[model samples]
Target: MNAQTVIVADDHPLFRSALVLALRGLLPDATLHEVDAFDALQRTVESGIDADLVLLDLHMPGARGFSSLLYLRNEHPALPVVIVSGHEEPAIMQRAFDFGASGYIPKSSGLPTLALALRAVLDGEIWQPPQLKEAPAQALEHRELAQRIASLSPQQFRVFMMLAEGRLNKQIAYDIDVTEATVKAHVTAILRKLGLVRRTQAALLAQRLLQAENAALEVPAAEGLPVGEDDDA
Candidate 1:
């Protein structure tokens, strides 16, 4: 198998750089790219950069909540998206899932945890570690939404995420190096694919998925799971 390319996007330049450098050990020979905010995230992605995977910040500047995940899905639906966030709120995780994140990892998570999450998604498994939520109704709601959003293509997913982040179509097109007409076309397709009504509904669904996904990462490390920390591959 070829080394998977990975993009890490965040508002903090140093933090994002560190992640890219650190991840090289995880994906040696894997091309890495970094972008600071949602706008740059789109630009980096749409500029013909190649990546088999994306490490996206759920709350990067210019993008809020789970919208980034949605946008990535729309643009690169086949590419697995792993939520890289500083926030560990259960609700936040769930929203990531609702928006269609394949995995979720906290910033505090060490390389072992990051490796597990990344590999889990690449191996075609849901990337959440598992959690017990007190509210079954909330969990059920998220599952319903996840099922709906799961069918989106990467491009549709990216567009959906951006919409949830309160980004305008013009901004998205500019960032992605596409025409405004293309962005509108993508937005329409995203809505149809997710069976959503308004952009607000799509945004709400993204939030729910992200939160639901976050709720699932409560498991301890699995036995025999390879653990790597600060190792440069």
Candidate 2:
């Protein structure tokens, strides 16, 4: 029989160890790898580890935000990735889907739910534990926000969204491939267009807009899932 294999990535060693123990108990013969952050996770996968799925942390330092989600999906294509996060902010969760996460489970969810998410993915279905979706937030309008979004240029939009995540100016500059001065200029324009009072306001506006738009959209994965409706493992 083919042995199931999984990898868990988070910077928290103790937490990672606990999950490893639980997963080891649950899956028995399945192989598991634990990674501390994006670099470690990426390198481990690149080192030729055959992972059937990866449980990833979204907000860990160096996680590359949703970009790493895209990266992993891009690289493995068929590999399933279930987000293991402490942050259940709907926008981030939505972003995970946009980047092609197969499942999402909050760290606070008990082991049963985690196991269910893993099983669902293993069974060729995407999973998002219902309990995690109970988080409260004011609803925003998508079509209206899309109309508003038409005002920003592509570069300006990138800066605006990155800044909305509370990323520092330097980080935004680095991410958008512009001068810090250019980022500042873009920020100023974003503020002016949105009629914002401060950078914080702009950030908040961006957050609201992102949520309203439910901007997390699933791109077609670079690879396909396993070719059968059932598995013998």
Where in model 1 is the C-alpha error above 4 Å?
130-137, 146-233
- Residue-level lDDT of model 2, residues 1-233, one tens digit each, is 23688888888888889988988877889998878878888888898877888988765666444545655765676889998888767666655654567998888889889878878898889997675367554334432333344456657667767865878777877876777777778878876665544666556556654443244322223234332211110
lDDT of 1 by residue, 69-125 (tens): 766766577778888877776676666676578888878888888778877887878
TM-score of every prediction relative to native = 0.63, 0.58
Instruction: Write down the worst ten-residue block by lDDT for model 1.
Output: 224-233
Best by TM-score: 1
- Worst lDDT 10-window in candidate 2: 224-233
lDDT of 2: 0.68
Q: CA shift at 1, candidate 1, in angstroms?
A: 7.3
RMSD of each: 13.4, 14.0
- The CA lDDT of each predicted structure is 0.67, 0.68
